[model samples]
Target: MRKLAVIVALTATVFLASSCRAETVCPAIAQASVVALTVAPEYVSSVKSIHLKACQDGRCMGADLDLVPGSTPIDQGCEPGSYGGDGVCSATSSPDGTLTGMLMLESLTASLIEVTVTGTGAAGQPLPVRALAFTPRVAYPYGEQCGSFITAGVVLDANGLRQAA
Candidate 1:
């Protein structure tokens, strides 16, 4: 009985020591307040130029965003030389004519923000202005220990602007 107790105690000690040395390793990734914008597919080809203006806590920023072909991720293994791959799988973009852009901000503190989206068509004809007053969401995407980040999204469609779900 004494030998069994000593063995158990030694096992417990080794287990505790090993666990103490275990750590949560995180990647060295930079964080930012990025607002992703997606133009509806039906209007993607029509919108040749996009201008975005966002305001929060009395500070406002405006700039023209360069729209690019949008893609969604696939669970299949990544192909060679694919951008933003997880080393296991890559994103796939179909030629569906969907264009997307990003509106980066120095920081977004206020819960509520005002946004204005304006653009021109392929012929320089102005598209209808889309505006929205919505709140951004805060998330700890990497984990709570990694800290929180504020993210916002907007959609521009024939119906106008609306916050992303």
Candidate 2:
């Protein structure tokens, strides 16, 4: 009886210790925001193409943007399509020129990920702008009882540049 008890206690201790050190994999969240803007040429009119420079961390295998109401994730190789409607803006200028629009991001799970704009500049002049950081909540599976968390923000020049950012 005594030997059996000792064996059980040892097994329990080892089990508890191992379980405490077990690795837990949590979903990763990467996000960025627009802090400031700088317009050059002074007289540059009609919005063309907007460029947002962003930095990201973690394994973002793929990414997609929710530009239109029912727009789906298209191939990264193709040029980013237009938002609003078909006949909205006809000029080919900087899209980020205006700072009023929706920017949606989708990525795989990560432990800790964040994105931010490093800097903004024209052809040769660097502009002064602030960095925006955001932490997105995990999106739960559908019909699984848990509610899904959606992170929505303005699509800045940084996001339009890279995949992670």
**Poorly placed runs, candidate 1 (over 4 Å):** 1-23, 77-96
lDDT (tens digit, per residue) of candidate 2 on 1-165? 999999999999999998899564544543443212232223123223333333335422212222222122333343444663333323333343333322233442333334433232435444333344454445564433434544423233432321211
Q: Which ten residues in a row have the lowest lDDT in candidate 2?
A: 61-70
Q: Write the residue-wise lDDT of candidate 1 on 48-164 in tens digits.
A: 899999998888888899898876655556555556544455456556556889888888764899999988988999988889999998877788877677778898888899898
What is the C-alpha local distance difference test score of each model?
0.83, 0.37
Q: Which residue pairs of candidate 1 clash?
A: none
Cand. 2 Cα-lDDT: 0.37
Question: Which ten residues in a row are the worst by lDDT in model 1?
Answer: 85-94
RMSD of each: 6.1, 15.4
- TM-scores for all predictions: 0.72, 0.27
